[model samples]
Target: MAVPHYAYLKMKLLGPKGLIIVVGDYCKSLECAQAGAKLAESLVIAEEQRQLDRIVALANETPAVPALAKEPAGEASFQPSKETKKVKLKPEDPSCSKYVIVGTRLDNK
Candidate 1:
């Protein structure tokens, strides 16, 4: 007869958030595998967030207000004296718009 399959790869029940790997047939081994999987998942999430932050930084470098057909309902909406479509780089903040380009340049060099 074949050996019965056990729920060793049940990562969702084993850790707060991760996959459980079956390292061996023993229960203790499975526990260790679950821990390792959780650690790996945490690292992966951190790296993904770091990458997204870099992209956001790059996008913020260029300042442009998207066109709104109608002004949003609120007192905050102020009508401009003249229509302008070009994106203007705000002189007040320079760091807001240099991450993506700088990061890519540094990586290339």
Candidate 2:
């Protein structure tokens, strides 16, 4: 067993020739700690990237559905079925513009 002295960066252990002292370089220790932190960060980033890639793969596996196929538009066929009359905003300025297509279903009594 050894007694660690953090302030001096030394460890004292009982040896045949009295007490054995182990010394650590402060700069080297700092570099090692920083390197460990960087390694941890890189590992975390790699794990996150893997998760994202798996999500992308799952997304790709699903069949793609076209926008037009999803909601079949009936606008073209529906226009003929509805009896609509155009009401001009300004009756004086008549040039086939600024008119609302008002349905006559409400007036049909």
Per lDDT, the best of the predicted structures is: 2
RMSD of 1: 21.9
TM-score of 1: 0.35
Kindly state the number of residue pairs that clash in model 2.
0
In candidate 2 the C-alpha lDDT for residue 79 amounts to 50
Q: Which ten contiguous residues of candidate 2 have the minimum total lDDT?
A: 72-81
Residues 29-106, candidate 2: write the lDDT tens digits. 999999999999999999999999998898798767545545566765445437878888889976757887777775
Instruction: Write model 1 residue lDDT over 1-109, tens digit each, in one string.
Output: 2233355522223445754443444777669889999999999999999999998997798656656588676778763434333332554786655322122223324
When summed lDDT is taken over every stretch of 10 residues in candidate 1, the lowest stretch is 99-108
What is the lDDT of every predicted structure here? 0.60, 0.86
Report, for all candidates in order, the number of backbone clashes.
2, 0
Off by over 4 Å in 2: 62-109
